[model samples]
Target: MSDCILEMRGITKEFPGVKALNNVHLRVKAGEIHALCGENGAGKSTLMKVLSGVYPHGTYTGDILYQGNVCRFKNIKQSEEAGIVIIHQELALVPQLSIAENLFLGNEQAQKGVIDWRKTKLETLELMKKVGLAEPADTLVSQIGVGKQQLVEIAKALAKKVRLLILDEPTAALNEDDSENLLNLLLELKKQGITSIMISHKLNEITKIADSITVLRDGQTIETLDVQGGELTENRIIKGMVGRELQNRYPERHAEIGEVIFEVKEWNVHHPLRPDRKVVSDANLSVRKGEIAGIAGLMGSGRTELAMSIFGKSYGKNISGTLIKDGRQLNIRHAGDAIQNGIVYVTEDRKGNGLILMDNIKGNITLSKLNKVASGLVMDERREKHEAERFRRKLNIKTPDIYQTTGNLSGGNQQKVMLSKWIFAEPDILILDEPTRGIDVGAKYEIYGIINQLAEEGKAVIIISSELPELLGMCDRIYTMCEGELTAEFSKEDASQETLMKYMTNRIKKGGEAYADTGANG
Candidate 1:
């Protein structure tokens, strides 16, 4: 018997003005963790969709052999029946449903069109235990954190008797601890003889867990490398994914930092839902013109809360803050006021809160400031197209034209569009939260270059990132946040990953002084 459990030959898929996949091939051995690596829009997700029946059998020309038999699946149901299941980046669980209800949504434990609640709960518990999830079966999906919710998804897959499991960017939204747990679970599942395929942009995680890796670029197969051979490294994988050796992960920048351009003093924000709970407290930070400042903290450390609250109180309740721009205190009441005062915030949740996915690139790019491309109450389509085209070229957004739908573009392109929108607003202070999250190394390099260019243009940029190395590489000054308080501050010359992490995890007591003085007014 052959060891190969799955093989895709000569797969070709296309759409209007786009050849998403062209003559792609993939082979996955039985009971081995196979990783699919590529830059954004490199046909990774499209190939998976074709195999899982999202595009159906006839929509694409391909040969799929599963378990020594040719499989022509016309829908996801047929694929699932054949023991092939795909979990998307955006989880499919219903937030309002209970754990048990979500697990057996389509495949219920029932008799005579009536559900057996007792049997469902018992089986749910068994599945939960298998995935190391300790939550009760009656618990609502929304009640659990993202990590537990991911486990619920896996338990659901196990319930279907899944033989070949596929996951797309599983840990993109998870923190360090949750990501570690999920990767460990995958290793455990491999021990149980389950075949898995994981698609991820995280090169570090891929190198750690993948038994074999297949690199794809520009909608075609590059090469498959054996991890056991002891020759495969992150640099080698990068060569295959981007078709060249990237000498530096971060682009070089000549920072010309000037006098203080923006300052936030004694900023405090309470939770909107729970008014008594403070989300950000006694924060003091300053950014100089032509400087890139960074906020380094672990997940749930109030970095985003602080940025949002500072940006016209978009988040939190009972916000009290002093915003000084160029030595003048401003009273900003809303997002519009912030924009008018030349302050813009680029949200981390780009898909959820940043862009209108349905709108085209031209609309999204010019959406932030309509006055730039409008006369009185009427929009100038020609001027709008000109501005959008200019930014698309400026950012090197990979697309056929400015009329393409924003949702159809890749993750990296979507982020560029979001940046273009804010840049069009002509902001003096830019707060970018997770600017390079979920993007490949090539895209990250481009984004860092863009940030450098913005700073070169004399904008005061504040970055909030989960990746410590990114902050260390790009920021001229870095501040550490812990439990809603500014714990410490360090200059780029004095900061390292180890030093930043120490202060990030340092818990600050209430009414206590910061570990280090920020050297700014409070």
Candidate 2:
């Protein structure tokens, strides 16, 4: 008689040195959107993995009841057969495959073990229509944008006849418009009687869509709030997740800004693959010592491209620019050169381009500056450990030890390790791209404090973020980019979300001209 479609009771999962989940309980109603919220390492993902059979039944002590029947799944396939499917944050689609091919990868529409092309295409179209994806079945997944890719993922889940869908950080990488569309699609799915459990760090989205919310903290369930009961609020959720009153989302900082120490003038870059297409155009910006500068833009507005191209021409082809540091022209050709000249870029793609996940924390922390922990071509293990342990404590990394593999650490801890690596390089100018992209509010506040500390130490810091509130809160000055052009600049006092968004979406036309006239120097 209970309306719960899925119930996980007394789940306890442990690893070699960490108890990832302890007595965690979750219940998803028949056709409601349930949100799972917590800090970085709070066992949200681990519990979901157990439910989807990634950890398997025997690997953990738990009881899973699906539709009032005891379910013991041995693997992902068994769970899928039982109508439970999990779509991970890192999408599982093959880039080279067509949309139809990726959708029916393992669960193919076939006759005698061979694919039925006509039937496959027809089903693919139907599935796409359900998720509001209008892409052709023959179109390569690589050819579509990230928004379209997410739709493909959903359509794939639909193909499996998913009764209970679990999504991990679904909108973490999506832009605003794409995130809205995806959230709307989930509502549509709910109307069709599909139950969903969403694990996300975006509290606003949770408050907007989740019917029931379960908060987890440090491997244990804290509390669950009902949206219909008016018990769901961002502040209340934050209090549960962090076990305290957050007070202020951004830390207080007193900046002692000095003269401009770094400047890029008349910068232009062409796309790496398409030489005729420009990615960054006539961009001019400057950062002073003890100042946190921010670049605001929509996705594909060339924010990341500008940052990467400046960090020793690591991106784009036919790059033409003048880099000035402390009133002197500097020529930098590569990342090593940029580092040598006291400039470092912490990449937005932490997993793909920043950290070596398989390596230990100590290895990743000392990777960027091995010589600092080296004794004449030999690595000093003691020094490396000492350095890594220092940063771990300084950043409150929440790891068992520095010897733990980076892959096992949570998203926030992995990001801290990435920052520690670049911080160890002893750079005078630090550029962070999407520094808090997938991080929770507590983790984001900690990162903001770290940036404040860097500014206090007289290091010029530049942040590139899609979240306007983050930039408004943390930056001493903000720059808006639109269509590969630096459109406008505003001091901290003048920068508001509305104004920044207007420039970000290219609503104001004269801002670009004003920026060209004054530049960052003005």
Q: Name the best candidate (by lDDT).
A: 1
Segments of candidate 1 deviating more than 4 angstroms: 509-512, 515-522
- lDDT tens per residue, model 1, 8-101: 9999999888998999999999999999999999999999999999999998897999998998999999999999999999899999999999
Q: For model 2, which pairs clash?
A: none
The CA-based lDDT of model 1 is what? 0.93
Residue 313 lDDT in candidate 1: 93
Clashes of each: 0, 0
RMSD of 1: 1.8
TM-score of 1: 0.97
Give the Cα RMSD of candidate 2: 1.4
lDDT digits (tens) for residues 1-522 of candidate 2: 999998889999999978999999888899999999999999999999999889988899979999999998889999999899999999999999999999999999999988899999999999999999887899999999888899999999999999999999999988899999999999999999999999999999989988999999999999888987866669999999999999999999999999999999999999999999999988888999999999999999999999999999999999998999999999999989999999999999999999999999999999999999999999998998899999999998978899899999988889999999999999999999999989888999989999999999999999999888899999988998989988888888877999888888883544437464434454
Model 2 compared with the native: what TM-score? 0.98
